[model samples]
Target: MRPRYMLSGNISPPSSAMALYSTPRSDKRTLQRNRRWPGSSATRSSATSTLSRSGSMLSSCLQCRTSTCRRISISERVICLILHSRFSFSKYMSESHLSLRVCYRKIAVDEGGLPSWANSKYRKYTPGKPHPNAIEYLVAVDENFFAFNITWPQDDSKKYDDPEKKLDQMRAYVTYFVEYDKQQLPRSKQPYIFYIDSRWASLKLMELLHENQLFGVLSCGENMRPKVLWSWIKADLAKYDWWSIGLPRLSANLVCVRTKDKVYLKILTNYCALKEIQYKKRKRKFPMTEFYVAACDVQKEYNAFKCKVDQLNKAVLEYFRLSRYLDDKVTFTQFFIHLFTVQSWTYYNACTGRSLSQLEYRVLVLQELAVEILPPPQPSVLAVHWPKHMGGRTHNCQYSPCRNNCTYFCIACEKWGCLKCLEKAHLNG
Candidate 1:
């Protein structure tokens, strides 16, 4: 079987694909778009996209002779993949096919900020001169920026950053996206969204941004704030598109309408189920205009997900309720009986791909009948996570194979949790 890797439309790392949710007060669910990480659509125009004169390193690797060793890139970030005659790893690895690391880096003097690599004259090229760790640089760097961390124990408290290298890392980051965009971006295009995940990273980038006079859309949540953050950065806020809701917040999927005041955060619409309890309890503080439209869009998405969940559950229940007769040994069409006698939904059935016995399968099927409705577990967006660095009371979230990957919990309605089922349970909920 061809190996499959998860990819997101934005510039984020592959494994960190987040299934974002709109807060209870807001009806919309969203996977906030990353402006720097343009989806597959952006790759069509390579001339204006990532690479400069060196062009894409991975694509350029096509000229590699069989069994030959060739280094790719015009910057410090480099990756080597072996190609063999029998298998088409080459076919599988293409610009269209998303890899989790930086496939290409730029080598422009204006974009390059760091001291030269050995091949600085002929070094690996990366996206603009972003810090190799910049969200956009990481996207272009590899198909999996943190693949080692996917199976990383959620409970383990391992620190990845070294304090000494922080300034250097931050410099690389600003060079990647901010500097890269300044060079290749068309004058007509608005800046792409660069999500700031931590307070320190935000502080460092904002500081570098003012000094360099570069611009991009920066989105972040509440925990990212320090008391003096906005106070100092507010002056240069207009230099770029700084999209945020000052409240301690989660990333929303729907495109947010930008405003100067916090009143937009309080605004809700008639269509949202939350309108009655959250917004109507008090007098309206802000005038509702475009936000009224955004609220409606959120509701529309939520309702669609809600309807899909209800329909799937009803079908699964009905299928099991009526499948008994066909499951019998003496049935004419025993194929489906075998298919479901396995009890596809059960944890063991899915793992072993078999039931311990027919009687055991029957018991498992009956268990499904007892539930009036089974709401699958929901996984929260990876962006709005309860950090792995901080230990929590809930070890493994209410999802998965005891991998200790449970890091998310919903205190809003006491519904849905952790990473495993975030998309199914949380989105539908």
Candidate 2:
């Protein structure tokens, strides 16, 4: 039988909390009716009766109990709830053309204070990074603002030979999604568009995407191949201000745009067309520029949907954060725990069509988990026994089942009994 959690206390936020989300009348009513906590009297009684048999309670030893509680399994329960519902994962994937954003998150640590057992190749402290003394992870997030793929943690302390194994890591990350689509999202026919930054973008990676029938919008640097286009764009930067200078290619379109700040933004996209390039002009004061900032269709599209992985990082960090002192395994475990919570939160929004603040959702999840993992308190048993000493007195046993004369008295019940009756009255009781 499937286990059900019946929490026996009020754990929901006040009704006014719903006002913050401005939830619809129907959703509000549903939440009030369905939110589980101190449910009906029958449920509470049933849960109490099943607590010991269900084996949900923690062990007596602290270390053994901690080891038994697996957060990953708990997260899987959240996924199970979503899967059993009418909401179809494959359908959702097919309906939306998701933008897959690839990025990195630094798991900072203190090098000097690290424990002796923390001897990992990837846990070295680089001198000049934002998280110089930290471990790094290659993370991928979709348009839903939830991370679905994560690479093994990289060792940053080694010699800076390659840029995070540029082409190799990209292929690995893309391969995961491709396989996932084939298995879990069989109906998802459309290919995903990956948003890659200039540092990680390469010709080989672009070719890989093409071979897989996927699309990508990659940022190009000034030194990127095809020196002719970069040279022309740099020479005539002002002329292309507020204009999308398109150099169409067989597999990609090289787009260059100049903003009022005098910075040239180079973009390479396989999905965009020369005719689809939308340009707009906005006048500026201060410097008295003719057209301040040019908004190109390619740039606008990239800016709007990209950086979702970064956004995921922001969302996770806003509430709780993992301790830096943990080892690599424990740290990654904590990171995924946070990601699972965010995933559940995103799923809730999609299912309900209402936006509940992250904080509130986290509170609700905590309360629900409390019900699943916390066991009901047990009633204290009365310990019935006699005093250690016996005075020179004889009396009949006061126990209902015994009829004897002796000098044994039970201090617990303040009763008398004989030697044989005392054993049955107190010791065996």
Candidate 3:
């Protein structure tokens, strides 16, 4: 026979802590229900006698005494006692029925990985994609200048002390470049394109563009120059004259080889607005804003926004006056040269409204002309110059063109290199 396995414990009512205290009669009812009922007096007495014997056996088992042991095989009685104990123990469980229900509901809802139902309520809705034809092509360019600063030592005794201006100047140059790029590029492109160096600031600008949904192509180092990217854009826009002019113009001056070229400047203006507004008191009592310049290269120039009969005649006369300077029938190069020269003069006059000395005016004109003719100097040519014989044997010469050196050099030139020394040297020669 197989060895019998049974749970060993005294079958007793649950403790006061576990029992249902609110219902005082529950324990009595449980006991009554578990007991056998409606028996003859002799049978009852026999049952009582059996209960007494079983109770004594249970007490002996608790004390680990085996002298008087008894076995009872009533499975129903055991099951009923377990049920009563469970009901009594449940009273001590802390969670209320309502709280348990809520907990189960939460578990059921979160069984899946994500709350897809909540997504509909919390997530933003996006519209359908735009029609291909409705989208417009846009291009933007940003440019900036880089320069260095220099500072001079204040004390004569501290020969080794260097100035702090050079670093400050470089900082300013970079700051200006960043500001110009931000102000110009966004306005120029539809969504906007950003052009910048491979420096940290440039990377930051690109990030800003990306966040704005502005499309742009980044070029590192020398590739970041505006001329290279803008040339292709201008060529593309050449076919659409009106649309080209309507495009925004970047405020940052592009560093282009052809930027100063007469031909390129003309081409650029063809798609850009180059206007010289001259204000004059008019007789008509019109809004001051209405008196502003209304002009375009292709269309007839007029005083008013609309084309009126008398206004058209005046516009025709003005157009003829302006066109006389332009090469209407010349080759592309000659035409561009003429346009570039005339526009340059006009822009100069507008910018410097006051009368200037002949020398000053000539210098300004030459500078403008040179911009078209001269290419940027090579790095070697533009490199900082240091005097080889500055200090006695060229040893410890401070050959690194310090702030004091540059200022001293400029002053020496302006003062004509020490008049007394120059005269003595001349006499010796």
Candidate 4:
């Protein structure tokens, strides 16, 4: 018999009080945030029940359960999601000109089972099938945002006995990663970070990173382990973007690196925006009038509401534990489910014509407790309009390099100098 698993829509919360309320909740904006609905809070539970239906959808798709893997069936929502994802992944595969077989993880015959595999000597190391490296790929998930880290070791011998196979594997992995980022992850919210240790840094990989618009330190030698607080700043921020200009490694001292990076400064600048965002959040605030009308005892109603939330959250957490992220299909489908579900709940709340209760608001706030959004980049003046001492400064002599400012500038040096200086600056001045 297949057990059923249902997934309904929900919303995300603010970043201030994540620890207090870990359940999914949100406001009017984020999940297509301002969407409208025809129902009220009374129907919210029904919506969740309808989505889960028999809980079969996820069971069929992923064999895991909330606490343990069990026999289960797939939900219509999850099935449809899987189908949609296949189409998208197919399109991506076609565009990248890479075969699908290569992109997915390689599965093997393990008939002997876990105990046998565990006892084998070959299994102790990289073995026939390679084990994943911690530094190479790491995922740090919070309520609103996720941070991923990818690195290559100083020595590349463990991956594959054949060097060519390793490179192919890397390319395939990177292809999926890039696409997964575009399709699933929300880059508009904040830039994704990538840390490429110089050890196995490839030209093609670096090019891919730059296409995403980030910084890089042109290091030719070994990796630098961070020692100081400032350098740690670079280390921390570098793991969250597609390409990070990683800290220049110079000995064990953090300050020894040359040319400080603006990423840290930019990150610091975002703190102010983060605070503003926090200030703007509406939390733990419910519609008192609606609550008063709905129940004779507001306190009792509040307690029941809190209990309901807790129970639902537990179910969600349990179901979520079953799946693994080996492909974009699962990640994206799950994300889509999570995304729209959140919006639906928020919209439903609005329809309920009730103000959010303190407990509800707190749950919403918890969703974003760890998430921090980076402020949009400020607009910059064109190079043509910049002052000579700004980006316009040139190492060339006072001679202007261009003739548009010929009256008072030196065309040879792009300097704002008298025409006379053009002739004498290089030779005499």
Candidate 5:
């Protein structure tokens, strides 16, 4: 007996050579005119009349020949011929067979009149530079606070994990001011000094200073020993001729000013010696009381400078309010106002009762305020509309995965539809 094998359902062999050879040739005419435009109505009517005559002739020939070949109709032949001529077969059929046509007329506008597409009237505003005499200071402060939990023992494993990130944030905080200084300061003059809190007195910060070549001062907490800080100051002084030391006084902080001015330093330290020399030359006429009155006038001028800062802050806040968008969800205006106020307080603490000269105090106050009111953050997202085929992609589509084949959200129709569907349903009709 012959061996038998089980067969799977619907198992079939591939097509034979004769089957492949005998397959009908694809209509090359169909491929040629896939996207061709339909001819005018008069041309289409003429072609149709010719096709009818050909049909009659073809039918009579087929009846006489009695051939086994499949008959080709006149309508089909005329379609192939029309398509080969590169005229739109589909559009011709729609116009002649279906009886419909659409034509658009262009409109022209005279000079000085706006175009049809003109929409908005308001122009964009560009900001200008502030005055040179304007005082501005860039200030950076960092505070370390311990995290607590209800659990018995502390979770110290996460301590080092956050330091790098925190350091990056602090560095970014100072970078903004550095950019501002570069833009506003003249190339000839040295950059105004940057001020930071004591926690940043790390080797990491020093490395950053060396890398960026920045001139700045680091103010430590009151508990930092004076002798140790003095040693650090002397070492820093050797490298940089200009340095300022902030020390705790009876009620407030005192910043001892020093510079590379050898002549001025000697004159300040030995005023009596200078006076004695001046007496010998018979040039010491003015009493010391006159100098005291002059100093009091300088104090009055400093008070006027403080008033100007207050005025500037108020003006900046008002400008911020004007620029705020009506639909803004964030309280950015209020945030900026609070920021300016905090900056003013820091300036007051750094300068008030610190024996700062009138000119130095004014400069510091203005610099601090400038850094505070550095332009507001730009809008997070912008809306845009682009013409089809312009290579623009929609961001917020109704169909995210596009399983249902929606293209994008339509605000007008309140629905989502693919481009093909939209063209067929709305544009075609």
Candidate 6:
């Protein structure tokens, strides 16, 4: 008897596979063109077409290495499996702005299936060096680490001096967030705040955020703002350790804090006032482990919520690094698989309060998928009875009185057994 694992299903392909493997329109055209004449020997092209049609199912089945997914296209097979298994995990969303911590992070993917046209148009070049071929994705996540708004792969190359062109990619990011926010949290009364770093700060973006009735707490850089104002702020830092200036036209205020060694942190926001609030930080000198408290509401809010997106990025990288599996042929499949894993992990942790680590959760998911979708290995030699590795799976030894788990399957006996069990069952008998 076959050993049951975490999940059980009939050892057959689902009905949905039939729809996926149905003859495509282009294949039908080839059939009409390659029809053999009744009275003449079949042409080479006709024979070729016949062979291809006959081999399609066999090839697809081999590619998946599974009888249950026989004849299903690889892309469709993966997507179908994902969709089918999605019923077990629930989707989660923030209820309102009070609980929502909106932040943005750019996910840089190296050597994926990004289109060449967009790549060339937005490729970045340093003063004396060429940047790598990579696709940059703008991802926005809530406090729960759920990535609600994700952009398609785009080039991150931008001109630092031109704020308009600099935030061209941000347009899509903001649009997606706004649309999703309206649909998911329609009853929430407070405006949504988008937390972004200095690279994304600009007056034009501020206007767009205000237009959408959203707010932002963006870290500002000298190069990202007008030179005159930036210089004024830098010089004025000599007289005062910290100060804020309000821009009446943009309905935003620029706040700068002069830290130890004259290093300054600047923030631009329409939501946060120029009032001070208590916050703690590590000392900036040697033995920096000591904590100190300061009063600044803008810095406090920015520091408290700025790392949500970074945390999400860290989780995606540290837990399941998908870069090694990313290839041009299966880029789409692998990318979505990673995305789904992240979403599932976040939602599971939020809803269940489970103490499972990210790595453990991923392993559990893989085990569940293997039981449901993966097939047993084919026998190399039917005439010979020998044990074969079960592809990292373990089953109870089928030999009577043997209670040990085994990773090897005996072909002739059609049973899972350890080496000792196999030797005793076959050699002794």
The alpha-carbon deviation from the true structure for residue 292 of candidate 4, after best TM-score superposition, in angstroms, is 49
By lDDT, the better pick of 3 and 4 is: 4
* Model 3: per-residue Cα lDDT over 171-284, one tens digit each: 222232233334442232223222221221122333333333333222223222232443432342221121111111211111111221132221111111222223333334
lDDT of each: 0.28, 0.48, 0.23, 0.26, 0.26, 0.51
Candidate 1 lDDT tens digits, 284-363: 56654332222323233332322322232222234332232332332212322332232222223322344454455556
TM-score of each: 0.21, 0.54, 0.14, 0.21, 0.20, 0.56
Compose the digit string of candidate 2's lDDT tens values, residues 320-387. Answer: 44465566777555555666677667655654456998888878777777776896776445444644
Task: Show model 3 residue runs off by greater than 4 Å.
Answer: 1-302, 305-332, 344-363, 367-429
lDDT-based ranking: 6, 2, 1, 5, 4, 3
RMSD in Å for model 2: 21.9
Best prediction by TM-score = 6
As a whole number from 0 to 100, the lDDT of residue 398 in candidate 5 is: 39
Name the better of 5 and 6 by lDDT: 6
> How much is the lDDT of residue 154 in candidate 2?
47
lDDT of model 1 at position 360: 56
lDDT of 1: 0.28
State the lDDT of candidate 6 residue by residue for 1-429, as single tens digits: 221110123232234432221222222222121112111322212111221211111101111111221232223333443574442111222233123222222221111122221323333332311224433334555555655434443334442445556565555555544554445533444456778766667777787666666667888777764645555445545422565555544456666776655678888777765444456667657888856555457777777777766566556545333343345445444445666566555544543456678778777767666755887777666747888999889999888799798899977778999999898888889
Q: Please report the TM-score between candidate 1 and the true structure.
A: 0.21
Per-residue lDDT of model 5, residues 1-429, tens digit only = 110111222222123322211211123321121111111121111111221211111111000101111133222322233243453234323222221111001100000110111122211211221321211221222110000010111112222232323344335433433443344423313322233333333334433433343433333332332324433333323211222211111011112122222211100000001000111112245652322111111122212222332333343333243222322223333433333333333323332224444345446546644555675576443322211331344333233343354435444444455565444545555
State candidate 4's TM-score. Answer: 0.21
Candidate 4, residues 226-320, lDDT tens digits: the string is 11223322342321121111111110001112122332221100001010111111224564232111111111211222232223223223323
What's model 6's TM-score?
A: 0.56
